[model samples]
Target chain A: MNDRLTAAERVAIARHPQRPNISDYISALFTDFFEQRGDRLMGEDASILGGVALYHGRPVTVIGTRKGKDLEENIHCRFGMPNPEGYRKALRLMRQAEKFRRPVITFIDTGGAYPGLEAEERGQGEAIARNLMEMSRLTVPVIALITGEGNSGGALALAVADRVLMLENAVYAILSPEGFASILWKDAGRSSDACELMKLTAADLKALDVIDEIILEPGGGAHLARAITFRQVDEAISRHLAELSKGKQLGRYQKFRRIGTAVPKKEGQ
Target chain B: MNSIFAKRRARLLAMKSLREHYVPVGSAAVCPRCGKESGHPAVAQNLFVCPLCGYHFPVGAYYRLSITLDHGSFRELYPKLAPQDPLSFPGYRKKLEAAQRKTGLNEAAVSAVGTIDGRRCVVGVLDSRFFLGSMSSAVGEKLTLTIEYAWKNRLPLIVFSASGGARMQEGILSLMQMAKTSAALGRFDQRGLLYISVLTDPTTGGVTASFASLGDVILAEPGALIGFAGPRVIQQTIGETLPEGFQRAEFQMEHGFVDAVVPRNEMRDTLSQLLRLHEKGGPS
Candidate 1:
């Protein structure tokens, strides 16, 4: 524990520009990856990419938040921040997975839900809310992997899964440490302090039971050892999928239902 | 010639004026929107809506229940379920203590079983005075249990939501509340029970994106702020001044997220009418 990276350092590693992203995992782990697009109600949102693919010869629906590998791509992906259509499109894919009796796998890596005027006008809140409600009741196995940053409702919208896993350096938080610092302390520069207090690192979340397991990354970061990181993550997902395929339905609902069962101390104690 | 745009702008102006400070006169009420002074008793008689401008004052959960529920029909649930410092985040325990002392509430939300216009329903209210009505783990648990109770008892559910967002002090655990409550509501929806979510002033962020938006019939109070992101955050992100009445209840209704914008004076009857219409048979 003494030599482990601090939460702030883990945050930086999770957000490293060259870190393995959703597309990398999809290419390495799945075959017959047919990229599906559009919410059908609206146009396409490139930020959230989802479609049908075959994993280990078993057909499954795969969805993930994608950030651009470079600057030009980042602008096109809205820096991995999704709009209403993006969430709607993900929901569309999840429902499709349920209909086809295929398991749903999602990768979460986002700054947050998009905070633009058009997003508000398009009912961003409703779209994400619809996902949380729909994903909870989907009668198919669902799994989520947090490979990088998982921020706020944007990340949780895709994460109401039977099993949630995170990479060693990945950080999943309610909001960025900078945003937390500015909101609470009124100073964004105290982000490192906020990061330490937030407990956003994989080990912290695992201890708190927020996430199920931590997929060990190669020393330094996943970017430094992409092949090994992919193998580790692939094995973790496959193991969880096999365990979840035993037809234990409604565990997705109860898994979340059982979190945070803290009872208050009675008065006059 | 009552154009829709004109009416919308006027409604926005009325809400903007409510943000101004009211004159503090003894035994008298000053209309925050119109700057007109009236007897305190008169304002109370009118249910706290400004007589001159129709601006509605933000009410506490208990006060809301007192007015909305049938007399002597209210029974509280989980009244002692206080929050603990799950993460030991800095300055969080003291903040909780201060909020508890100020709001006289164990948590931001209050859940109960009561009769609305003599019809049995489960009521949950988020008190904005308590940490700006943020959704902490305790708040989330209370509301989830309330929704489950409603489902088990075969009763209607009415939730008045007024929140700033997820409680930042609780960190990631607070964010999970959005999922927890939404999942509970999902199960409730399967029974085809009635869930009428009433959005009051300042419902945004996690609260807006969960049970508040998943209602069978979503209603909002006039001039209430309802959006995914707050106005200040959006303005800062976009570097542009927001349009007038942006994210207000009227704006949400216009954008089709809210069913209607019901004024404070008419909220009870409107909800009663909705509850009655959704009854299995004719109005009880």
Candidate 2:
């Protein structure tokens, strides 16, 4: 409660080393989590972690972008940036969930898809594009939570859900503010300003209707309270799942239809 | 008006018409990448694309529209959807005005309806010369309206994407366009209308994240730099040197990010072929 951080500092805390990752969430919430691998197109990517899991005795498919906590893990996880295979793997997992009529839960925390030549050669854009189109048609309930950095199409690929949630301190943006500053002002040092300008904080996203709900973290942020954060997130997911299950069986496309409509003119140009 | 080279030659020909410059094209100009000096009449004749190395020079939206559509068949839409600096980000208004002056456009992207090879489509092109065709509120609004119009008319839609991503001056307002444009495309998809995205040189950032990457049939011009983050940022983040031609058109196509890599010279024919295949009995 004492650590009142700026938006930029909160962004840093969001990516803090001590923060709980997706694996931690799985261990804390779900049981009998069987890991799934590969998109079955080319090869397996360690960046996307997904599989069948039983959440509160209900069969569910849990998928998300995984960033390793340490250097070796990060390397194994490709620093949380997925190749096309990771997206495809997620898609494959989602389709499986649909066949069994299971609700889908995706944990989005990535700096975006990998921007390497090899990744592009593997169909990164197409993978994301297909997710957007197919996820709209997914017949099962879908929920995405922004646990950390939700950046670009990589984060968005698994984020087309019926109800999108984010941690209070989490940040979801088209790209990192530093990237934005570098592209716009030719200086990455202006990133903090860009961060403020970009309005990437969860509250801002909620205001813009980009997210459905925000789960507040423990005092000082999620890192100071990993167990508590995990429980809060589990509660949020369970609540959203219950709501969506009771709601009519409509495609998630309805969630996006009203977004980004033209705002009323305010006498400016 | 009959030639793609007409506006390109307007400055050089001094009201003499494009024919006067055709003879001198062989030794006239130089390719920036290849550093070869030539008149390049074929380049002008082929939509200002460099003949030797396939370098795509910056093209204004009006000239691009003329080059892509049937002559005298384009009807511009939302030409006056001017932009306002909602955030009042410093110097944005000035830079926007400068871009407008240089490109002779109200915004970075222009929306219009036109007939290409007798197949009517809603078409728009981003002028690379206009703040590098960045997406502002006006740009997104115009494109959204264009998509909506295509949906209403039951027409195929084609857009040329050449942007430096979202307009930084607009801040999150610019980012919202990403969601807005994508949402509109979702509805467009429901209608089963064909939307072709043409990524030219340097399609990156927010633009790549949204509608540019959501095309039903995505196309890119040869040697265009296309991706979400710029090469420099990626390089810094990875601390590794990128491979040669990493984000080029060929690279994107091979990765399945793009459907086809069309050179500017053959874009019209390629688009026409695609249109004819997707056409549902020509307006029934």
Predicted structure with the largest DockQ when compared to the true one: 1
Candidate 1 local lDDT, residue A185: 85
Give candidate 1's error at residue B273 in angstroms: 0.6
* lDDT tens readout by residue for model 2, A23-52: 998999999999999988898999999999
The C-alpha lDDT values of all candidates are: 0.88, 0.79
lDDT for each residue of candidate 2 in B1-284, tens digit (9 for 90 to 100): 45555344334322222332322445666677898765656667757777777787766676667678876566677767778876667788898788667555677877777688888999978876777778777787778778888898898999999998867776656665665577678788989899999998888877886788888889998889998667876687678988998888898887668889987778999998989989786633
Residue lDDT tens for model 1, B42-90: 7767777887788777777777776787656666777788888899877
- Sequence-dependent TM-score of model 2: 0.85
Candidate 1 at residue B2, lDDT?
34
Model 2 misplaced stretches (Cα beyond 4 Å): A1-3, A248-254, A263-269, B1-29, B37-46, B51-54, B84-88, B170-176, B214-216, B237-244, B254-259, B281-284
Cα error, residue B246 of model 2, in Å, equals 3.4
At residue B115, give the lDDT of candidate 2. 82
